[model samples]
Target chain A: MRNRTLTTITVVLAAGALALSACSSSKKNTNGGGLGGGSSANNGGTNQTYKIGFVGALSGPNAQLGINERNGATLAIDQANASGKYKFKIALNAQDSEGDPAKAPAAATALISDPTVVAVIGPAFSGESKAVNPSFCQASPPMPTVTASASNAELQNQGNKCWHRIIPNDNVEGSQGADWLARTGAKKVYVLSDLSAYGAGVAGTMAKELKAKGVSVVSSGVDGTTTKNYNPIAGTIAASGTDALFYGGYDAQSALLAKALVAAGYKGRTVTGNGGKSSVFTTGAGKAGNGWYFTCGCQDATIAPTAKEFTAAYTAKFNTPPSTYSPEAFDAANLLMDAISKASASGTATRTSVLDALNKEDFTGITTQIKFQANGEVQSSSLIVNLFQEKSGAIKGLGNIKELN
Target chain B: MSQSENWVQQLPQNIIIGLEQGSVYSLIALGYTLVYGVLQLINFAHSEVFMAGGFGSYLVVNGIVGHRHMTGVMVPLTVLCGVLSGALTGAAIAWLLEKVAYKTLRRSGAPKLAFLISAIGASLFLSNLAGKLFNRLPNNAFPTYFDINHQLFKIGNAKVTLIEVIIVGSAVVMMIFLDRLVNRTKLGRGIRAVAEDAPTAALMGIDIDKTISRTFVIGGALAGAAGFMFGTAFGVSNLMGFTPGVKAFAAAVLGGIGNIRGAMIGGLILGQAEVLIAALPFVGAQWNDVISFVVLVLILLVRPTGILGERLGRAA
Candidate 1:
């Protein structure tokens, strides 16, 4: 009886293990196939389709920004498809990276392996883009990637020919932000960065620019994740009597700092880089976010004119207005399709041919005129600087603030 | 100026910020220590329980309150709901883990190593489960309810807000209450008895299984409270639990795995250390995690058995 019972237990355990493995494997296959399947659909000659993959955080804490990018990309693709200028249908394979550096490579790898993918769109945040950029280096006819939101200088400095981005790097954004602070007649600026590559790089760059403009960088540093209360730091900033504060980080910490700074009686204006430009900051900080300024690559209102029809189509499809990155994603899709059409016109749609076409192409996007320099940084005329208002809980885009010549 | 004045003047503001932030870490650490006191297994998924509490409160506040502006009893009530949800989830997770993983192994006389492995698996499974269910996005935000921007008080040159007061005060109160319960209550005796010797306690008519379950529930409740506090303090996200979980675990180990008081002490020390490290003039803020792990390693090196040393018969 004991021997039979042992066998039964063993069999039950094995079955359970098998079931768990099967379920997990199936989920992985679905995501993997979802990314690669777009490429396969494009392979059929009569119904030639081009797939572009956009990887970013679509549903996490950073969902607002990622969703916007996704929406922008989708709108652009829809317009391109409607124009009937391309022989193939433009399909986007979007996967969420959850804003994690570790998961970005896997997502990028999956997208790059797809044979029919002409170009890649994003990994959203700079940290994720930097994490995944190394993988594109080894791909045959290297994957041409256009980061929709990545701004860290390290991404451009990666020395990889395949990496390209439409957004201004942190150097430009940081310089502009510092200049804004200086314009406010702030003699001393207190700076805080998140300590991530994106945060530190931007903060460091801003400090350099602030010093160059003869403004004192009174104090600068990072806040640890374990540290929750920001009042003490805000108190210190107020006590230092710095004229303004510049935070180079994402919305979560920025919101907390904004609240704390206001509570601590810092009357000066506050500025943050692109990562901090989100509705979350205004919402989380509430009325304290009033008069806060932020700089990003594109303003939603500027894109609104070119994107009105796209927005209407997106609302018709997704039943809501596209989030911030959607227009960029839409533009990316169009850029890819434009390149693909040019490449396919020569009989075969080779990756090299597609890349060559992408290199020479100049497409006007909602955000900027998308043209890449040798290093793949978009050669744009200006970056958007916006003032976030607590009442509207939205960024009032102040158009493109031209770069200082 | 005097040398002392000069030193004070030169001390970086960022370091002060780091220390203030450490206060939250201390609160989360208390929960980990309390649970480990009786049930020696590290409550690996406690962080997720805290995350659930935050999200739960966000849902309630966003869905029910409907008003953009929050005030009066609404903030406290929302926090309470958040705490309750977190506690309930933690309790459920602890009970399920015992029933599915630990209980069977204990009954079969499996080695302790097996239980450790199972616990790790459970932690990974829970984290991934949450990731899959929620779209693996790390940037979700807790719905803003209370506006914490108003200054509540100012000390000399420093200003403090109601939010800071709430976070620091509540954490302290909870810690004291937990200490009193463990030291003075009959339930606490039962917990001590079980921790001392489960087989002997059972022989003395102390329901071992029930005590363990109760211990888990209490720990879960504490973790839930921590989660609610975290959401209110720092905001919420799916992966928000990860760093806190690791830190809380570090605090537990720092305090001594089965020593309740040790966890409390360890947590405060770790929190303060992390903040101070981040605030250091040269180090700045980005070294927060780097500082935390460094302190953890130092603690382990200096006192491998932790501040309190492991309790006998508590290796569940």
Candidate 2:
């Protein structure tokens, strides 16, 4: 009886594990996909309505970036439909990849199988981009993906040809950030990351470049699963007595670290990769965020000339200013829509026609003129550095926002 | 300043940071352990109670501060309002969870698994409701009214900050108060009697339901208070309670599920381990959580009743 009961327990446990794994590996049913300024809706009707698939994190720690992308896409779609440019209505079919690579394959498969989905706007972060690449490239008459801000170079190294990101790769962010650090003349630097693929990628590259530039670097990783106390990392950074501290992580932890660092009385200038450039970082860190500089390739209303109207429209629509990469997200959507437009102008725009159109396009976007190279990289992608400061006791750009050439 | 200069020198500061964090964990853990003590059922919805407290705090803070900095009187007043609202909200939500979610299961004499499933459903319902009401993204923009991070004192390389002092201070006061209430008060005796022998306590005219409800309120209030302290340090979000909830559960199990004092020690130990393990050069912070569960497993293997829990006959 005992042996039989043991077997039964094992079977039950195995089934439970399998069920959990199956559930965790998929998560694509989330169609409302935008948690920030994203209108919650179901599938666009099966008739007369063309669908654009948005595959990124719609609900997680990384949801802010994805929502920014979704809002941009939604904004673009709303504009095109309103303009009566296309005879048919375009609807967004946004899926949550949870910003995780494991779930990306299922989302990719779901997007590829949808007959109405002519093109996709994103798999926002670099790791998710890499996860979806092979599946997207391997699809028959491969679908094109235009990403606003997935900066990892490995996504391009896969030679998927189906992936085109307007933003510069991690190499650009790392080298550009290293240049700024070097320019500040900080010989000894302390670096830290949340240890995510994106976080580690940017931090590792920055550290390597900083070392090559004859700077001494002390680096560490913090637990990013959830926002725990960041005081230890802040303490280590302060105790190190580094001239400056550079972080390669998201805004939430950056805010906490900045708060702790300020409390610890660390006088060094705090800088971060693209992860820290968002308004979320500034708001999250509050007063302690003052005088901290961060670098990003993502276009925001505050920085881009092309984004002024979009920002105004976005603020009017969402009642809040768009975050770091919304403009790039808008540009990316425009690029994809442009391809769809090019394809639709011909008889029928299948996934193949969209893919073909994506390769040969020289589309000009507000953030930058979108042009793709052979390896799906932008021709000359760049990064901008901005500092957070106190203006009228509110944490914002204090004086003039300086652009690092 | 390089990595070569002994990392061990910073251990004291790391420990202090860990204790502050652990204090927050202990606050949340008290709720889970307290509910378990009386009902003998895990209340998964308790995390939602904690999250509710955060939203309560966010609303109060939003009303009081509204994106502007305040000096002197406004700071303490704002914190007081936020914490009180948060505590009250947490208490109300805990009472509701008992009434709406678990009370039926208890009355029906249903199996424990049924209660667990219902608790989980309630947890998801509350989380999604919060997500829908508030934006799903991290609502971290609220200004901290009390901006006290100045150095309080120093021990070796570790400097104590005012924020840490407040966090540790509030947590210890609450824990001590609850411990005294559980051990000394008339209601405390009733709760202990119910925990010790529910049927017997009921026969003795001790109101089991009332005692259980009171226990939940106390736990919920402490958790809500902790939420305000935690939100002040880390920002609040709809999903904020989850990780701390899980860690606090681990802390409870490590401390012996029904033992209040054990939960406190467990939270502190877990917090210290999370930091110290991460402090080790190559293993890093990622391994800290893994070490936490491992420690729990080792403790269970060595002493199934936990450090403070007694023999089977003396379980209470």
Candidate 3:
């Protein structure tokens, strides 16, 4: 009788363990293999709840960008829901990617598994966008990912039918940045990247442009995300006697690099791409951050005439001023909503219908007029990248990138 | 200039930077060595202890120098306050760790493997707790009261900043103080005795538990102080300790895991190797970690035990 009871307990425990392992294995597979059996059959009707998913860095070095984007999207969603123009209610499924490519797949998988999610706002940085775009494109109905800030030029050529970018890619920003640098009379430039898809792509383009412009350029790579010490790299740059240092990475690492360069007595023109345009860089670099230059496709919403009302609303809602790409995110969210609205006009909005509508969208936004080319690139005539400088510890806009040349 | 000339020009500054980086590693490594000396266990949670010190000091420093332009004597005083607070916080956490993770497990007669598991569990809990409470940003700078990067001197075209001076100077002083504490005092003797043979030491009227606890406190104080210097130089964050912590652990092993002096030497060597090798014109800075570990492996292969192989019982 005792042996029988023990055998029964063993069988029960084994079964429980097996169930636990099975559950965990499924989660692991979803994370690794991307979303499978992908999109759910969701019919967007009156009073139906649809989730607009956002995947980006909610908490990390690049969190300000994601948070800014999230806030803008949130405002757009709130405005849409309150307007009562749409028959369906929109809810945001904001997922944190932590600005890491390795962590982005899981966040993307989470959104794809949900049947109600028709559109995604961002995968934020270019590396994450690259990592998750295939999965998004491979989803059953192809979940549409409308990115606000990912600017890698090669992203549009990935053959992902559902991927759309509202910003001008690195091909424009990088060449424009090189032209500006050359106009600055910098004979030699040291180009550095964080080795991310975005950083490398932008830096690569900049190097090619600089070489074409007859400027000597030296290129190197570093893992900006985990590296805390930039002193050695600073020493390398200082010793090279480069007239300018072009860093293509996020704000936090750039700030550290700026500080290290100062300590190493490097008196060169320091410039970075849009990724380093945050107050995090300016503040973290302290006095060293002064005189650093930045190139960005984002507009200064606080000063822009068209963005006055959006800025007021954003500040009132989020308590902080709208940061880089906030206006763009607002536009992207509105564009998505317009697509969703169009999709639902005839019948119910599905992932495929919303994507089709997105491909055909041509709306005027605060930043620029948005329109996508056949390859998911923004083809706006008014698309502009601006040059910004940190003077006396505050970032000041220095007009347009094209005009600088 | 030639390629080698460039490296030669940059050598002095790189050495100064490496020294600053190495000193912090030494201070943290001392804690790991101290714990291992008595318990014969690697406390994986020591990294979190270092991180906690940064946050603790950040709160104190931020409270004292909030938006105020500190001048004159107030600058050094504020720094001193930060270091003291960090040390105290680290010591308190280490004590709690010993009681909860080590003592309880030992009292229950748990296997040695359980201790390692518990230490890791404690590390995860503390780091996540820190993230939840403090800023989760990876580079949360401490409130800047003084210019941390003000150039104090130049040697061979290499400038040395005030923060570097403070880091190396304080690390040397603390290591000396720790050396005396482990070799001179009655507590030191007790700790050495316990580390040598806990059962026999108990037989000789030495309180094994108390000595072990004090060892942890001493190590914790040093690490906490290092955390302050590190945070001041880089920035404070819940996750700041991982890299330095890993480097310090390797340093401890490189110098001889249970030897106090060995840990110090190991850390300094590791730091310099990382800087000099990575600063090579052809190699680049991305190879910093790989080069340092390669040096460590080479050294270990040559001297299997470490650079200084004597255990804490004899070396301390």
Candidate 4:
């Protein structure tokens, strides 16, 4: 009787274990299939929901920036969905890229594989976007992508019509940055790059332009991605005795450099490319970031009348003011939706049709007029340069938004 | 003005800079070796300890010091607080790990694979935890406490900053102190004994648990110091430790796991190799990671036990 009872207990325990294993395997499959299904199926009916994929650095060091961009895209989608303009609802499939170039390809591949995905919104950092661009271009029927944050010139060099950016490339932004330094009558400028492709590329271009304009480019240095202490480099800037300091990098290192420069008693003007124009920079560097300037492709919140509505809606929904890239994201989503509408009207909204629609797209966005050049460069005005104020610890619009002729 | 002459003149300066940078790596590598020596385990979370230490220093400098700019008292205080916090955190984690993961397994005589899997899970958990806690924004700067721009010395054409001198000098001093503690102390002996043969050491009256806990504290303290220095020197973020932790682990392995002096030598060599690789033309800067990993793989292939063999014990 005791032996019989033991055998029954053993059978029940084994059955439970098998059930748990089966459940775990199913969960993994669901996660993988969900991403695939979410992107592939457009709800396939008259009342179908159209999906747009967004890939960005949502969970790493740049999570805040990524979330802000995602928020802007969400706002646009929500508004469109609520407007009842189409036969389908808009759904977003957001994935985190972690701001790494290596991770961007995987994220891009995941988004591109989804057949129902009409367009991709972003992979914020220029380096990541550039890395993923080729993979996107090679996709069957070629995915039409609109980056909210990427501003590198090289991205447009692909010569593919599938890519349309809402943000202006760094060429305009870099030229604007150079012009700002030159307009201030700064004779000598010290330049430092983060040593990444994006940073080195922008800093090199800025330096070249500055040098061509007869401005003395003194003391160029390269910093590693892991660089935290900017004192040694900051001291070089201080000692170089340049009128202004220009850094081409993201906010983390840029903020530290700003603080280090101030600590080293550097009283000169400071400037950075779009990558440095994050709220984290202001928060991290605090008073040190004050009076520092950054040039970005997007207009400041104050400059965009439409942004006031965006700000109100964003703040009400997310409980925070949108970051610098928020407007660009809004523009990208709206621009894509415009393309989608055009494509659907023409015929079945296939990838090739969407790509054609994107190329021919010309709509006035919240930030600026969204139109793509033959090279996939956004035909738009130059970026606005904002100055970070020490007292407010916030970036203030500096009345320097330049239009590219 | 000749190319060869310029190259000759630059060599000594480059070496000095390389050595100074290598010293920082060595300090972090020591933590990796200490943990591996006693437990026969790699604490992937060590880098997070380094990151946490940096954040700890940032908090101390920003909150307590109340200075946005570097001041004289800020550096030492930050480092002190950083090390304490790191050691405390490490000790707590080591204890918890033993209680929750390793202890039951040790009793059951579980396989080594289980421990490794558990360590990886713990690492991912801690890293994600930090990401959630820190608002996931890359922190650009911690408050500077001192002017790092002052030149301490010049080697021919190369100029060395005061910060470099401090970093190298402090790292060496700490290493020497650690060497003495591990070689000449009773706790050190027990740690060495356990690494040699855990069951035998247990039979010989060594308290394996206590030794392991102490080993973790020591490693954590070293990592903490590295974190403080790294944050003050470079910057800190949620994912800051991932790459460096991998590199330091590589350094530990290259120096021969469970070997102290090997770790020191391996770290300095790796740091210099990375710097030199970055300087090579055509290779460009982006190839630094590629070069480091290739070198690591090659080194492991040639010398499976690393350059120093595991029998060197805990003496550096």
Candidate 5:
């Protein structure tokens, strides 16, 4: 009786495992094939189709930012297709890196392998951007890449020719934030970084700028990606008795730190970089999230005059308002589409042609003037860093950081 | 004040924070130690069981509270509901895990390595399954039923929050209950017999399979409760179990792998060491993980087995 029962149970378990494995394998095949296989052979046909790849954290902690960017790009593509203006149909081939550098290479490889993919919108977070930029640069004919949200200053030093970011680098945002702090009468500032490429870069710049402005700076780093409890760090900050605390990290960690600081009874003003500008930060930190200042290269699309239509369309399509870099991503997609159109105006729009067009083209976007300098940075003349504050549970823009005084 | 003076002032609060964090680690560590006691197999899927408990409690709590602003007695009642639901869910998952991942292999008489690999596979399957079922957002927190950050009391400069008190109190109560259960109950004797000599215990008419299954259930219940506390303090996510789970596993090993009481001591020591060592101005917080492993290595070198020595049969 026992033997029969055991055999039946074993068979059932084995069948279940097999079924699950089959389901997962089939899902992968469908995702890859369904998205990338729609490439039309361009033999002088106006109905030809091309894919624009977006590689970012579609899941995980940074998913909100990536999802926002993907939605923005998707909206642009849908609008362009529906407008019947372009000769070719534009499709988005989005790959989820889950914000892990280890997972980025595979995601980037998947995009680069798809022949129809002319350009990529993002590798979203700075770590994933650093991980996948080499592949994007080293691709045959070199794939053009533009990031809407990655703000690491070190990314510019990577010397990748095809790399471009619409947003200002960490150097700009960090300095502006420091200047704002100085103007606000913060004498003793505590600067904490997550030790990630993005966090460290911004924190280092902010600390340097603060020191230059004669502000006493106490600096430290924690690997916020792995550390869950911030109370010990909060204790150190509270004990330091600083007037302002500046954190350079993503939303989740920053939110936790805010909660910890509040729990520790630290009354100091709290500030963070663009990485903490999402609704996740406010929601995660709860009431502690209120009255915190955020410095970002991206602006509020809902309030931008040029982005009114874009904002409305995004809200109507996604059933949620455009957030964070959604407008920047919209501009990036539109910029790429413009380049594709410009490149194809005279001849076929190959990867090389698209790159040439993107480099040479000067266009106006909803966020800023879309023009890349020799080193793939947007022209400094057009780049601006804005300050935002969380008040009464909503993140409100406080205008340009330079204009904050 | 000077930096040294600042450090001295911060020491009391840092210790309080460390103890609060350590208590949760101890609860999770008990799961690892208990499973190791009977099976001599490291169940990697236990982490997923922890994650499952968090989600399970989240569903029950979210269903009960919804968007309503909870206050007064509702807070404690809600927390109790969450803990019970979490424990029940964790026990169910762990039971299923043993049946699916361990039982089939055990019946086939597979090697120990196969069991380890299967546990890992099961862990991946369970976490990803959770991600697929729930939204994959990392910051999915419980509804604010009450002020989790409300100050319950204070130790020096450190304010002991309500959540911290609940976590530490529950963990202590559970650990004491677990210790007594293992030491005094008939099931305890059966478990000890199986751990000591499975074949001999089977010859003596104690059903080894039932004892092992029950042992897993007990461990799972503790982990599930820890999961609820952890989720309340931090947020719940599919990947939430990885860090705490690894830390708890380390605590289990540090306490002498199979020793239940040792796991408890090791967890407290590890937590205190991590927080206190990282609190030093020169060392900084980034070196916290390194300090934890270095302490582990140093302790292991001295004791060879662990702080308290290994084997549940000999110790518990």
Candidate 6:
């Protein structure tokens, strides 16, 4: 009787373990493999609820920025419904990417397999944007996506036509920054990169443009995203005594490097590309980041007359001030809605029609007048060069957004 | 501006940087070495042990120090509190890991591969735990107590920062203390005996499980201390452990797995090799990781037993 009971217990435990492993294995498959029940089967008729998918960071340090972007898209969807512009009621399936490339493909695939998602607003960051491109592009008719802010030049080079950006690519900002710095009479500049797909692309492009403009690049090194000790690199910078420094990375590391550079006796000017335009950048550097130049594709919304209405609407809706990239995200969301509207005016608005409309998209948004190039890059007025001053330590815009593609 | 043209100019600073980095690797490597020495199992979860130490330090410092400028009594006080918290955290977690993950398996005479997989699962669990608890930002700089970059002195053109001084000094002191503990003490004999022949050691009146547990404590303490140092210098993050942990493990294999001094030597060598390769003219820093691994592969190919040879692993 004891032996029979033991055998029964063993079988039960073995079955439980097998079931557990099977569940874990299935989770992995959904994340990595193709979505089994493809998107087309779920496409509802004109009266069904349509979702404009949004994917980006929503739960980390950059959470505020991503939330603002997501909120912007959400607001656009709400506004479109209120206007009664389309037969279908539009909503948002805003997935949290947490700004990780590893998490992006799954998010993108999930969005792709939702047939009611007529368009996607973003995979907001450049790195995540790149990772999710395959999902959008490889879809049968291709899902159209208009990004709020992913500006890595390589994204356009990927030949992913379905993915469009309202913000000028880093190629514009890097080239313009390099041009401005060269015009400032700096003989040499040290270029530093975080080596992310975004940072490297911008820094590399800037270096090429700097060399072309007769500015000598001293030594391009690293300000690694996770690296804390900047002294060694800073020492090299001080010893090299380059006339200026161009950092291509996010605000946090840029600030850290700026402080390190100051401590190492570097008195040269520092210029950060689009990625380093947050309050964290300045605060992290303390006094060191003051007077540093930061470039971006969007002007400060508070000062722009056209942006005033959007800013007020945003504040009223979200009950908070718009953060960095929020206005850009707002414009991007409107761009998507506009594309949908244009596609539907002539005939039934489908994924292919919406994508075709986005390809030739031209709209005067609050930030810039958008026109996409053949590479799916937005043609903005000009890239904004801002100074991280004591007053406007969070990247004060000097002029218009650049790179009309 | 012309620094890249002269390889000699870049070499000294790179070497100093390398040594500072190697010190952290050596501390973490010691954990892997000590555990591997006795159990004949590579404790992959040891990295998470180091990572836990960092988070532990961060919480301690944040609670005690708040955000204050570095100076006066606060500097040493914060350091002491943080390091202690880190060490305790590391020791406790590592002990629990051994108890929950490995102890039962060891008693059941599970295969070595099972231990490896278990260690990996434990590592993932701890990392995710930290992530969930502390939002998964890439970095969260501890409130500045002092400028870690204030130059202690210059070696050639290299500016040796205060942080490097702290890292190198603390690592050396800890490594020495551990070496003496392992070589000279009565407990050391028991540990060595158990490693040599556990059944024989048990017959000879040494408690096998106790000695193994104590070995973990020592290794974990070292890693915890290293984690604190790494946090102060690099800023604490959830993903911080994996890279350094892997590098330290590489240092372990490169030096001679299961050997104490071998890990130290391997770490410094690997660190210097990485820095030196990155200091090369043009395309330097871009391929540093690649070259570091290449050197390791080359060295292992030349000497399979590593520099000091496989001395600590039990020979069946």
DockQ (CA atoms), all models: 0.34, 0.22, 0.28, 0.20, 0.47, 0.31
Please identify model 3 stretches exceeding 4 Å from their true place: A1-46, A380-382, B313-316
Better by lDDT, candidate 3 or 1: 3
lDDT of each: 0.68, 0.76, 0.85, 0.70, 0.86, 0.76
User: Residue by residue across B294-313, what tens digits does model 5's lDDT show?
Assistant: 98899999997898888684
For candidate 2, what is the lDDT? 0.76
Candidate 1 on A1-405: residue-level lDDT in tens?
A: 543543344445445545554455456445533533533455555867777778887544565777677766766665666666677777777767767788778778878888867778887888887788878756887887778788898787778888778777888878877876677688988887777778888999899999999998865665534445565566556656677888888876787787777766788768887787776676677667777777766556434587677667877766766655567677777777778888899786766787788888888876578888888887746345433333356566665454321
TM-score of 2: 0.86
Per-residue error (Å), model 6, residue B1? 8.2
List pairs with backbone clashes in candidate 5.
none
Candidate of highest lDDT: 5
* Angstrom error at residue A2, model 1: 12
**Residue A342 CA error for candidate 3 (Å)?**
1.3
Fraction of reference contacts reproduced per prediction? 0.28, 0.37, 0.38, 0.21, 0.47, 0.18
Displacement of the residue B64 alpha carbon in candidate 1, Å: 5.7
Q: Least accurate stretch of 10 residues (summed lDDT) in model 3 chain A?
A: A32-41
After superposition, candidate 1 runs with Cα above 4 Å error: A1-45, A223-233, A302-316, A380-391, A403-405, B1-27, B56-89, B128-160, B293-304, B308-316
lDDT of 3 by residue, A1-405 (tens): 543543343344345445543444344344322211122122444377677888888775678888888888878877877777888777777777877899999999999999989999998889999999999999998999999999999999999999999888898899999999999899999999988888889999999999999999888888876688787788889889899999999898898899888877788899999999988888888888999999999898878999999999999977888888999999988899899999888888999999999998988988898888989888857569999999987788888888875
C-alpha TM-scores of all predictions: 0.84, 0.86, 0.92, 0.76, 0.94, 0.87
Query: Candidate 4 lDDT, tens digit per residue, A149-250?
Result: 877778778665577677767777777778767877999898788887778878888898899888988535555566553544554455556898889888
Each model's chain A TM-score: 0.84, 0.85, 0.88, 0.86, 0.91, 0.82
- Residues A319-395, candidate 6: write the lDDT tens digits: 87676788888788778878887887786788999888888777877777788878777654533433333344555
Cα displacement (angstroms), candidate 4, residue A138, comes to 4.0
Ranking 1 against 4 by lDDT, winner: 4
lDDT of 2 by residue, A198-303 (tens): 8888888889999999998888877676755677667767778789888888876787788878877788878876666666666677778877776776554665
| Count of steric clashes across candidates, in order | 28, 0, 0, 10, 0, 8
Q: Which ten residues in a row have the lowest lDDT in candidate 6 chain B?
A: B1-10
